[model samples]
Target: MLDANLKQQLQGLLTNLREPIELVSSLGDDAKSVELASLLDDIAALSDKVSVTRADDDARRPSFLIRRASDAQVAVRFAGIPMGHEFTSLVLALLQVGGHPPKVAPEVLEQVAALDGDYHFETYFSLSCQNCPDIVQALNLMSVVNPRITHTAIDGGLFQAEVEDRKIMAVPTIFLNGETFGQGRMELEQILAKLDSGAEAKAAEKIAAKDAFDVLVVGGGPAGAAAAIYAARKGIRVGLAAERFGGQVLDTMGIENFISVQHTEGPKLVAQLEQHVKDYDVDIMNLQRAEKLIPAKTEGGLHEVKLASGASLKARTVILSTGARWRQLGVPGEDEYRNKGVAYCPHCDGPLYKGKRVAVIGGGNSGVEAAIDLAGLVAHVTLIEFDSELRADAVLQRKLASLPNVKIITSALTTEVLGDGEKVMGLSYKDRNKDELHQIELEGVFVQIGLVPNTEWLKDSVTLSRHGEIEVDHRGETSQAGIFAAGDCTTVPYKQIVIAMGEGSKAALSAFDYMIRLPADVEAEAA
Candidate 1:
């Protein structure tokens, strides 16, 4: 199951093991079980400190536990083959269990160890999900730190019955003590904040004590990272407060269009951007959501930005790059059936609807791509587009046409989601051709319409367009002089990563120029 190149890499990584660890597997004679056993054997062959044993103790077949030989309480379980996006999680579990320290911060390690409650976490994940590995790895790290906190990462693709029973249509859904905990992509700080309420108040106090920055970048997407890095390189006090450090890019999958890089994944690029930013002197604050933007009361004065955690930051010039979020279908039952049957990420949640009929709402690149991807896994894919024709590229349209299981409907708008107070049953649409309503029976609905700018918080602060995007000039300056905006949240077109980065750098430079041109008295007072 493991290739030679990968085995060589794993062998090098396993050399970091300071202590012995055992892989206790509960497998059967099934094909998947045999594959899992083969993988376990290959892993054990790399290092003498690693060993594998069979003991069908877990109710979930083909499951395994990575337990520290010296400390049995420290264990993390995986209920299926941890390949695809989850391969990283598996490797992390091995190194962590083998006494290699995790990459988490020290304070977070303390917080994990200090937790007192019994948290039996079961995370339902899909192998193709780009966001599931973070949740799995975070929980695994917590389990290794606090024995009371145990985690089991279950592959929803393998346990189809359990997924159906739980009405789970999304990836990375977590259950704590048999109750729903959270869904979607979550970082370590976000997870810690949920379990440790005091952590928020503590973080707020720490943020409140910080001095005013010369340049403060709000949002932590590509634009925000670029802005922060550019400002920091100018030898100024730069601070970045982000709701989540990768932002929407974390949910993205393939990235073939990013310039110079040839091809890469979203998370991988975000990591490099973050590392580059960290190489500078920027003060980074993660998991900090901006609730309100209080522009500078006067010219050349500090602009105060308030956060959701009762913390406020003051900066001479602020760069808004909060970016955008997935646009939702406003139809009835859509919100109610979210995660139950309605999902937005086809790459992440496609496997959950294996052999099931589904509908893709939209005809753009994302929508058609989703239909094409889903056609291979689901029984049927009905693509409904609001436009008269598909707006996807010719190549994509050709590929979509080649798929035999896909059906396209043009000039139709999704009217309502049909559900039986549980999961999705079908959807109601309006046919422009006949001026009549239509309904299609399907088990799931994947909405890939597009994205909306994350500028709701700036509605009362800055000049916003009719579509809620921040109105910006050519210099990346917003309506306010000292405040600027960039990326998908601004008036920038294309909404590509490269464009965001360039705009971010321009906004930083503009802010610097604005700062230098301040009144002499204001400059002296600011100094």
Candidate 2:
């Protein structure tokens, strides 16, 4: 229950859009109806500025709350409040909106060409947190799997007033046909139940729950995708869900070293892998980030993959191939100038700094590699190292020294990033010895000091290293039963792409081994 004071505050907060206009229009001494008209206009404008652009004008009509396809009878979902822990909930909501039955089997997708149905789902979320990427991916997957399930996203922070009016509390809250369906992380079975009960609310919401699958891959990265292709060839039901269809590879600019592929770009490699998986009956879900892992209760019990979108999935086995993200400097201006001037992963955004002065922060291999790489493209490269000595390999150290334009500043630290509104123009630095301070003007700054794994969201659900990387055994098994961790986020010594892929495969097989001992009715209970 909301406190009275909080409720009044909420009322005031909500008034930012509608009631204020009515109050102002009242000065004209018009009838109540006239003031109501003014309020309606305000609501219309607010909705337009924040809601997803529908495919057609009629598609967004107020009467057409839920759009159903003739074949895939799925409920279109729109998550309006998605943020923080709610990011995973948004994915679950998308699954429900698409009318997918819990625990989808490979044979199920192959037999059904189109999942046509009409259902409407609305979700709310915030954009400030990095975890929201998973929710965005889940919604995207729903749209792709079943065209009937159109998705509309609402910015919770941008439209705080509107969200308050809707009485939204938790993020990733889903409302089906104007009624609260569920909150927090939801599973496929729970979502189907909501649809089953929402029919009288004016949408043709029906639950066509499918049979459970043999293997359910939770990520669509190089590791996850590779695993799916391998499993599918073996005639296993493999479903791939990821924040983006390409995983971390999407942000990568080039991939010169991938075997069997010569001089290929990152996106191109992802496209090829994606196409290969598409050729099979694999259920590939893009933009779906798994929030939680519900391990099988009995032998042969299907695993449950819940998303922030309020959608849930059931699988016999789970593979976590969710890759790591580029580390941030955690500096004040780094957040503000993220895409503007501050960047991570030299391979991703290094080209933007070409012919421009840039500073690479860190002395490790990444920092040294970035400095050497940027020296060829940028006018100058300033490598700042806090440590008295470089930590990179000696061979790379010589290569870095060979670059005439690259300057190494040891025993120095970045105090702050200096920049204007448009872009980063320069930065301030201080000597670790506290003897000197200097400022340098540069167009861009790349932080390669280190990487922070994406396992913080997993919390104590799995084993994490002291540095937060997931702890995996030789076979990629974590401390927790039936769960596995892999990639740069894991305790693997080498943070190489090949290594991450290998660990991912190991984790998949481990999950498969765990699943085979579960009960057959696990999907029904999980749903």
Candidate 3:
């Protein structure tokens, strides 16, 4: 079950195990169970400290638990084959359970250890989902850290009956104590905040007591990472506040156009970006949302940034790279049925709708690509476009046309997401050419329209374009003095990762220039 290269790598990693560990599997006679047993045997053969056992915690077949042989309390489990994106999760669980210390921050580890009450977390995930690995790994680590917490990462594709019973149409749906906790991507910090009520307030108090930074970068995308690193390299105090470290990049599927890098996935690139930024002395404020941006009362004065945590940070210069999010089709029932039938990620949720009819909205590259990807797993795909013709590249259009299970409809506007109050039943759309309204019965709706700038919070603070993007000059400087913006949140023509990194660097340089030219008295006072 394990390839030669993978076995070699796992052999090297397993040698780091400081203690013995056991793989307790509850499997059946199914093919997947046999495959899992083979994989477990391969793993046990890799290291002397590893062994396999039997356990019957649940009826789910082909599942196993990785526990310290000395103590079963410190354990984590996988309810399916932990391959694809979840392979890393499996490796981390093995290492962590085998007595190899995790690399998480000291404070985060303490928080996990301090968590009280019983936390039996069950997370549903798809193999292709880029966002699910983080959730699974986080919960797995938490379960290992605290005896009260137990996490089981279940594969939604393998257990269709449970998924249907729960009405889970999205990937990474989490349940705590048999009740819904959250859906979609969430960070460990965010999870702790929700579980530990005082976590937010304590974090806020710590942030409020910090000294004013020389540069405060808002947003944790590639642009924000670049800006923070550039500023920190100057030996200046830099603080970065963001909702999540990766921003929209976490949702992106595959990236091939990044310069120098031949090919990569969004989550992998984000991990690299975050690690590089951490190499510097920059202070990172994770899982923080900037609620408002206040300009300095004077030309060379401190600027204030209010956060949703009820904390504020002051900085001499502020760089905005909040980025953009997937644009929603603002139609009736769209909000009500979100995650019930309406989804924005094709790669993550496509597997859950196997052999089921689905609709893809938009005619751009993303839409065409989603249609192509879904045509293989789903029974049929209907591509709906508001444009008179497809706006995707000719190559993509040609490939989409060759698919037998795909049906394209141009000049169509999505009107309402038809649902039965519990789940999606179908959708209604308008034909622009014939002025006729039509409805299509589908089990799922994949939206790939485009992106909207995450500038709603800045609307009352800065000058925004008519389309709501932050307006900026050539140097990435915004309308406000000593304030700059970059990436998809700005009026930049292209929204590529490489371009965003370049713009972020330029914005950092511009901020440095602006600081140097400030009045001598102001500089001294700031210093």
lDDT of 1 at 189: 81
Q: Tens-digit lDDT track for model 1 on 315-431?
A: 999999999999999989999999888999998999999999999998999999999999999999999999999999999999999999999999998999999999999999999
After superposing candidate 2 on the true structure, give the runs of residues whose Cα lies further than 4 Å from its correct spot: 1-211, 253-263, 296-300, 345-355, 517-527
Q: Could you estimate the TM-score for every candidate?
A: 0.99, 0.57, 0.99
Q: State candidate 1's TM-score.
A: 0.99
Each candidate's number of clashing pairs is 0, 57, 0
Question: Model 3 clash pairs?
Answer: none
- Say which prediction, candidate 1 or candidate 2, comes out ahead on TM-score: 1
* Candidate with more favorable, higher TM-score: 2 or 3: 3
